[model samples]
Target: MTHNLQNDLLVRAAFSRPTERPPVWMMRQAGRFMKEYWDIKNRYSFLEMCKTPEIAADVTMLPVDLLGIDAAILFSDILVTAEAMGGQLSFEQGVGPQFANPVRSRSDAEALQTDVVHKLQYVAEAIKVVKHRLQGSIPLIGFAGAPFTVLSYLVEGGSSKDFKRTKLLLHNEPELAHLILQKIADVTVDYLNMQISAGVDALQLFDSWALALAWDDYEAFAHRYNAYIFSKIDRGGVPVISFCKGSSVFAPLMATAKPDVVSVDWNADLRHVKDGLPEGIAVQGNLDPFVLYADKKVIKAKILQLFERMRGTDGFIFNLGHGIMPDIPFDNVRYAIDIVKEFRY
Candidate 1:
């Protein structure tokens, strides 16, 4: 594990340096595919793994040992923030995260607790554990759900193709929504600051549903809070990467959010993102996740095309536009990593 920290693939990629090889890692790379993760899941339910630092740290490193990616995102879910917030949350295998007690009113929102740092201290401790074990060999990334995204889950009470209730609440009851968003945003900023203090080298903010909002609504609702989270981080040296799903619309806001690195999702055009983004910030992805299922030859060809498209760019990190699905072939996943590693610039 004794490797050059300064030259670490993830570190170089964050700085937009032409790495010795293009740094490669996957979203959800530390997840179910790994036997260690499955073993942990079998031993403990979802919440237990998150709360148990030793177990979470163990899960976080499995992908690091297996795929040997440039970095490790702390093993946890974004919804964990909501659960810590006094929102009652539980997961159903196929259904995803669900909130039993949601905030529909300003009073309900106010009644819920904020400043969950003390509760989420486990996440910070897990990072500490992973860092101690990695011995500074690999960068460990800290992440949190962006405020609006978190608030969306809380208000909608779970996942939704459309956040009509959330949007209606935002529109019909502006003060209540504002109060909720404001509190969540404040917590998010504090939480991320706390994570950085916990020893994470880089950070990512996930706005998984930002695209569903209208353009102006996004500016008023989501963008500012995401900006606030970044503002509290150590920008002087540390790296900050923002990964908002449905990135085409949000690409413009990436400039304002002030992430040192901005990740592009499959729905966005790489060229357009490159064109509109602010200078000095690195770009992280755009490959469709389903590409992992394409035949190996076709997958390799696309990877070569990605390299050519991304070649000579000072600040580019090759990654799937989203996390790899569980059904993907390990061989294809390995092949994709090889292609990313061969991208000299």
Candidate 2:
């Protein structure tokens, strides 16, 4: 399962090894902005693109080939785990993802399929396909939604701004919340291990909604399950990245969860976060994604500014604070990557 990669900078940086420069990759690097992605998107539904190994692998490789990023993340959605847990998932035109049957009651929580690895075989197959296509060019990253974030979607049924229903359930039925999180955590551990066995070089746990909780709430609901999931996964030396947006306040708490890397959002200062986190945990991200909208000169300067802040810091991976927007010009992304590649330590 070893990949003889030419560019192991991302892998080395993830493991906190010294590198010539910070290896660059974006969170949603493979989607929307590229014409090739739309070419395929036009032909298939979102689920079809994710389920089809060939298409998924092709999409995953697009960023590496087109943008020259140092890593390839599997082109899949976090809700796929929800789907595997026997929830019905669909993507609408204006709306992103909707769950037909959400986990609202204790019965709903118990109904979630505990045996998830077999059902998610397509993801592993897609990873294998992506690995074959990558030809050891760079490391492939596998990821899943953190248990709490997955629980939020499962409870709220879709994307939520305030997560009112989710928090209500957490407050009203705390035991039910933990029960569902435990179920999801069990599945997450099995699911991530499967991805690793399929040959991915690194993994990330995306707790996109962790910011919704207060400190005590986050510690009880989010951090507890995240820490358990991280504990159960056997990384086998591959770095695990824990990312949560709007999470500056929880950086110190998150560091204790022990992900090999902590990906910060745009608002958090990279140096400040780096100093707070324990030694040996690498830092990734902090660049504003909107900065890509600027002209090439501005983009280059902004990239340099981030690098300047991160200068002499080991275990740094250059990435946007969050996913790239759909309407962003493709060339701007290309130019940004070029800037990161050209910059020296």
Candidate 3:
């Protein structure tokens, strides 16, 4: 599935190999910040956009074409796996994703399906299309939600502020929580492997809600399942990235999973985090997304400051701490990418 890539900076940097400068890409680089995205988004339901290969490839190409990023991440939602696993998933304008039949009791947990890769074939189709569109110009990153985060969505029925139901399930029914987590981990392993088979250049596992758990709970529920998926996947030299909101605190634990890169939030110093990580494990991100809202001068200064701190470091990629917000100025995002691309080590 390899193609002659014009820019292998991302893959090289992911393996901690030397590069001309740190490769630049953001978490949600292809998302709503652009009028071009909304032009297409307005015509389809969010899921419609994700499931259609042509539309998904179109959306996946926006950042690469418009922003000149180092990579293109597949345009899809994490909870699509949940829906394929028998959750009645839905999204509202402001309510986000909701599962009509959430896993509540032991029976509910047991009823969830594990043989779901067949149902997710559209993702593979979309990947093929994205790769064709990329034409070996850059890499395409495939991703899935990490087990605990996907489980939280299934148990809570949607996004939550406190994750009270999820935590209570863990505290009140430890075995049940383990059962659900195992199912998710199994699906994730197969799902990621499917993406690799379909020809993604790299993978990223998003544990968007791992920060919600206490230390012990996180180890038991989050870390173990992520590690299991990492162990089972057939990566075939494709780099895998492990990311969570609390990576600044849990990166050491994350590195133990053997991910090629660990993406951290903006709370920690990028250089300090990189210094702490074991050698050969690359570090991506730690910039505040809100910084894009500042003036171009401020954005340039912040980008330069991060680059200065990371100078002489290998395996570093410049990116925002998290996904871009929808309302961020499109010009500002373009400007930010320009700033990162212009810098040199």
TM-score of each: 0.95, 0.98, 0.99
| Cα lDDT tens digits for candidate 2, 65-166 | 888899999999998998999989999867989999988888888889899789899999999999888888889999999988999899889999999999
Choose 2 or 3, whichever is better by lDDT: 3
Ranked candidates, highest TM-score first: 3, 2, 1
Top candidate by lDDT: 3
Assess candidate 2 and give its lDDT: 0.90
lDDT score, candidate 3, position 127: 98
How many clashing residue pairs appear in each of the predictions shown? 0, 0, 0
- Write down the lDDT of every candidate, Cα atoms only: 0.81, 0.90, 0.93
TM-score of 2: 0.98
Q: After superposition, how far is residue 229 of candidate 2 from its true place, in Å?
A: 1.0
Better of 1 and 3 by TM-score: 3
Give the per-residue Cα lDDT of candidate 3 at 171: 97
How does model 1 fare in lDDT?
0.81
Arrange candidates by lDDT, descending: 3, 2, 1
Candidate 3's TM-score: 0.99
Q: Model 2, 77: alpha-carbon shift in Å?
A: 0.7
lDDT at 109, model 3: 90
